[model samples]
Target: MPTVDPTVLERPVKLHHLTFLDEGEEMTVGRPDIDAYVHLPRDGAELLKRLADGDTPEQAAAWYAEAYGETVDMSDFLETLEELEFLADDDTEVTTAEPVRWQRLGAALFSRWGLAAVTLIVVAAGIVLTQRPDLIPHYSHAFYTPSLIVVMLTLFLGQFPFLFLHEGAHALAGRKLGLKSRLRVSRRFYFIVFETSMDGLVSVPRGKRYVPILAGVISDLTATALLIIVAASTGGLIAGVSMALALGTAMRILWQCYFFLRTDLYYLTVTVLGCKNLHATSRDLLLRRLRRLFGRPVGEPISATETDRRAARWYSWLLLLGYAVMIFSLGYVVVPSLVFVVGEVVDRIIEQAPLPLLLDSVVVAVLIVGQFVVAGLLGLRERRLNRTVSSQPKAGSR
Candidate 1:
């Protein structure tokens, strides 16, 4: 084990530029350069502030003791900071973060005029939908073509551009606030999803964080509105394609409501409730309850804030509901779709249908099955990778 030097308490402390945001009785302190953040009690935040402001660890600890009538272990605190990479070593150069690209565009989109324009578009779309309710999204919209292959291909292939737009909205929103973000492919349960990682958002004030978090949802709504208008104004295959796109986008919007999956709205809920680690805390709470019910030995008590523990009591029920919904969706939606496609394909093959007709059925079947196969392979690969990474030795450890 790596040991902390006793002399660290006597040395003057240096730190990279840090951002601090007050969250009720606690404060969030983070170094954006490293994208590391932690919640600390008000007293702890004050002590760290003093240390960063040129006070040696000893002096900061003495002040904390006098102010709070409790002496803190400065050595331990210094060690924790070192682990978080918040401390700046004298020999190490501190580099500034590069400016994020498209920041001006991000700023414009979130500005008052930009938001007003979106509001107008949404209102206009609503009026159009009211006049032409046929444009509304329905599962039937997905089958706009006679050929199942064309429908499947269009829906499958077309969703990526919208997905990119959705995730890009999130990235742009974060960039507006000078926070960097990156997009990556990830899995949500068995479904592959694109996600934007904006780790530096923790350093941003709570109120300003919502735009970045909800930007994707807003983008979805905008896309759906635009497509609905197109479908209403146009006819033939163009209208059909637009309707299909609208349906896909609308479904993506609905997916956000699965808050238990730690979706964007989930983070918004956590922020609104002023709860930290609610999902993990609720999961652990639920597991412990299940263990106790079966008279099994529950592990150690969960370490979480009182707010998180209190919220978890109710949030745990939502987690169960979320899982139930996932299962229900699989049975109600996925199974039926698979059965229909397979039955159709089998009928076409058995009857020795026309070459074009038979080829379409075969392609649809392969595409449908291939999606699940890819998802399964990706899931297994991610699980093994996670295991390997977890098994590796952490820094400063043997």
Candidate 2:
């Protein structure tokens, strides 16, 4: 086996809530995206089933495993039982130790830096909204006319700035848990984010998972709020800028809810379900779909196939919706946009187009590509660090 890192869970990864089952003995929380979970041992599974089957976890581990499987370690079983509050005579109160000095400092740095960054964004946006008031709904224009595309593009591109803030929220949440963070870049490449690392967030308690999940939305919310404040402060809706900004922020929040695209919200949903790798669950669903399409029997591991069926069902639906969105965004928006820019660039390179146009087009591409490239590099580095530490062996390992 390849070496792995000891601090695998200590890297900076986003955490979210996934569905949790509090079986009197077996409690498994799945994170579908990561495709794993903290599962109560099989020995405990019998008791869990019994509890659900009208028994209690206070039953001896012997009996529980007798009904389930022999996978449970007795001590861990008892501890988990205590965690679910099934062991009345014993309970592990949420064990929270004081954070280390470095942790406190990191927490401070994270909060301070995050706030500063957000403030900068708000001020810049305010200035733009104020200056480009004319971009807002004009005093006399008609419905969905010429400015719609420009405004939509502006809003679309503008939302990218908040992407980091989303990741920052995840980083900050990890920091609060006394973990060091490995922040990754935020950009989309070919409808896929080849680089985005949330490798270090696992060590934190499940209860603390919401911060990373909600961070970007928090940033978007904060930004929108600030924009609203500035717009209000300056009097009424200046131009269409306020409306556009408002709509953009609203859409940002809505995007998270869509769940069709695996945005931060998707991660959060998987976290809540305790499904570690939603990608895996999704793959499983896709496989079943493929089988069905081929007119094959679902058979055997059919029960396993049905595992997390509720969440799984949503996965298929969201996936369908997601691909539709992808086709529209990619073909209609991204491809056309890229083609236009590239055509203009090629023309300039061959001296068929003006240098000024070429220079501007190249600048936009560089700016966008540069952001993703940097983020991807950071993500790769995080994974490498984790793999390095996790490869170490235990003293008793064979």
Best by lDDT: 1
Where does model 2 exceed 4 Å of error? 1-25, 28-37, 42-162, 177-181, 186-208, 231-254, 270-279, 295-307, 348-354, 365-398
Model 2 global lDDT (CA atoms, 0 to 1): 0.54
Model 1, span 1-398: residue lDDT tens: 33777687788888888889888788988877767778888998999999878998888989998999998877777777887788888988765566778999999998888778888888889999899988889999999988777788888999999999999999989999999888888778767889999888888888898999999999999999999888888999999999999999999999998788899999999989978789989999889999999999999757788999999999999998888888999899888988998999999989999999888878888888777777788899899998997897433211
Taking the tens digit of each residue's C-alpha lDDT, what string does model 2 give over 217-332?
77676766565555555754353455566566666677666565567787788778866556556656777787889999754322322345666777766776777786787688
On the 0 to 100 scale, the lDDT of residue 165 in model 1 is 96
Name the lDDT value of residue 370 in candidate 2: 51
**TM per model?**
0.91, 0.52
User: Once model 1 is optimally superposed onto the true structure by TM-score, how far is the C-alpha of residue 83 displaced, in angstroms?
Assistant: 1.6
